[model samples]
Target: MEFSHRDDHNNLSLTRFESMLKTNNVLFFDSNEFENIIQHYLENGKIALAKKAIKMGLQQHPSSTNLRLYKTEICILENDLEKAEEILDELYELEPSNEEIYIQKASILSKKDQHQQAINALMIALEFTEDQDDDADLFSLIGMEYLFLEKYADALSYFEKCLEIDMHDYSALYNIIFCFDYLNKNKEAINFLNNYLDENPYCEVAWHQLGLQFTSLKEWKKALAAFDFAIISDDTFVGAYLEKGKVLEKLKCYNEAIEFYEMTLTLDEPTSFALLRIGHCHEKMGNLDLAVDFYYKTVHEDPLLDKGWIAITKFYNRSKNYQKALYYINKAINIDCENVAYWKLYAVINHRLNFLEEAEVGYKKSLDYGNYELETWISRADILTNLGEYEASIINLMQAAEFYPENAEIEYRLAGLNFMVQQNEKGIFHLKNGVLINQEYQFIIKELFPSITELQAVKNIIAVTEKS
Candidate 1:
């Protein structure tokens, strides 16, 4: 707030400073006026101007503490840590009780990746801080230092101290909740938030955090109550409205979820999240036309939203509209080429439309992208067999067997494919393995490869297994 006693005085300092810079005039200013000019440059992010002001201000007033402090701050911002430290060491000799000196020392230590040492410097700063608000600020700095050390419990304690000084400090409140969440202490977090609400009942952020904690515990009804309280505290809170909608949806109150979701549209701008939720609610309620409409709107509002395209494709796919489903899925794939879910759905749609080659490519991509679902493995194996790639089918099933060794279905598939390729010994071995896993699935042998069932070894194995 330098030169802040009057608006015209503040304007006059900046104007005269800039005029002197352009004219190369050796103009004189008092130490306080130089500070006002330098502060204006610093606050506006005009670092070069601030530096020039510092040089001139120092030459004019050789012993100004504020001017020297500003120079040290510039050095810190520019990462000239050595020079910054030299200035600070000099300043410390002058004013040993200056908290800003210690704070800047903490900043320099932090930049050197010395988080524990930074915390130590901040603790010294705390000893010198006389103002209650400055103490809270220093506490936040120490809490951040603990966070950088991955010491969540220590960070939480300091942030809690910050809240004790100023109950309305939202940043401290958020940091405290983040620590609780990182420690996975949901129950403890709920108790803490409940205590906080007792003191500051209208804190919507606390209520919102309480709701999220209850949601994580799967206490859906309790989460709904918490979100309701958040809305009561701040009706315009978009996060509360969205979370309430989700909780209602989880409770299968689809229509009620839709009501709250629509309210969000009026309170905020059109969001793809709200539109997507409304589409899901419509789909759950069997309103197919309305469901598709909202899904389309979801994609239109946010073209990169893959879930919206997926919803549209799923809706059409369920209606046996293979072509429509494939069209929407293509859009999703174009946006995110490596998305496993998109490629998996693309394979399903293309297979339904009898595009076997492209369907096989899609399945291959889904597997390549880490979609290791058992169904994906079997589906790709089946597609390989259809394309007359029997050896590839065997290899696919063998890989799946590695992931799911005890599955009788994969064992049976391996048995049939091995026999189809005239690998008789492997076929008989897999047949016995499959029957031992589940004799009820011998139909896999009899139905898919009937000739294998007629073999003496196959019949004998099944007979012995059934008796056992």
Candidate 2:
């Protein structure tokens, strides 16, 4: 009821402000009224109208400090930091104890990337802040400055202080969790949050953070319990439901996870993420038809969600329906041409269908788009070898070798390619190094070139290496 009244008042003010604008009667507005009008425009990002309002405001009340302060705010938004600081300095002189001047100074300093100076200004603002509720905001600002400086420990301390003042400060709680994650202090976070929950067991945000911390530690049961408590505290919390589903999925309880994911749909509109997870759970449970249905629903709801398309394509590939896989993957590629995973999948499907040239092109595209997976390089090299372009295959493997110097599979493949080109000495060198580095990878040679293993020289090399 109170919120509705405030909304009605704001609407009435906006209507009067617009009527005055249409008639050029804004001059009739007093200084306070003009300030309100300008603030409404500024808050809504109508910078031109805000400037117009400020002009009229200053013309009517040139001595108004509030109007001048709004001008400083406008200057700051425009990135005219020097002008903003000049006005702020004058405002500070006029209102020496005003907390807002210090906050404006902090904003300018933060924009300049002088985080420590911004923090100092906020500290000064804190001295003038009388409201305990405002102290939570001040602490959050100081925490944000420390975060910008990459001082995760300091940021966590300040965010914890903010949470102490207002336990319901969800943003501060999330920041504290982020800081803990950044520091790899999950165990510490669990202990600290457990202690906090001892006194405030009903803090849904704290319980949610504890669940996330347990998730990071792979303690699925504990994470599930934390999420359950969060849901108990606030049954409408969609985040808790989603996270509970994830923990169930992690535990390989697909049916239970699907129930939780479906619970979210009851509380809110079906999200693409929830739909995708339901599809994945069904897929894992061998309900391919149901999985495909949900996957199609996901894409229909959010056509631009590449994961949905990729999921459908991968399902087809797993079922060995190469043609359908190719068709859907092409659709995904059309949606996001720069996605390396899509290109990689495109290459794999093409390779399965024996479209060697197309597969090579897709592999090149994947690599060009920064696909660094070792399998991508190896698959491309294998295609080149199949085309009997042994020299090209060798060159490709050499680049892969540069990226993964200690990879035994790459070394073995290089040895095979060199042998195909009759580089006997080079083949012997790499073959020796590959077997010595990882003897298990000798199976790759058996799979790729069984006839070569029968060679007496190769057998001698293998025998000697095995003995070593």
Return the top candidate by lDDT: 1
Q: Candidate 2 on 1-468: residue-level lDDT in tens?
A: 111355776566657767877995643567877777787777677899988878878888988888988999999999999999898888888898888898889999999999999999999999999998878888999999999999999999999999899877779878988998899989998988898889889988889889988898888889999999999999999999999999999888999999999999999999999999999999999999999999999999898888999999999999999999999999988889998889999999999999998998899899899987898899999899788888988888898888889789998888777777778789888898898789889987788766678766678888987787
Cα lDDT tens digits, model 1, 1-468, are 544546897788788888988896889899988888888877778899999999999999989888999988999999999999999999999999999999999999999999999999999998988899999999999999999999999999999999999999999999999999999999999999999999999899999999999999999989999999999999999999999999899989999999999999999999999999999999999999999999999999998888888899999999999888998999889988989889999999998888888998898999899988898888888888778798998999999988899799898889888988989899888987888788888787777667667777778888898789
User: For each candidate, what TM-score against the reference?
Assistant: 0.78, 0.85
Which portions of model 2 miss their true places by more than 4 Å? 1-13, 389-395, 406-408, 411-468
User: How many steric clashes does model 1 contain?
Assistant: 0
Model 1: which residue pairs collide?
none
Q: Whose TM-score is greatest here?
A: 2
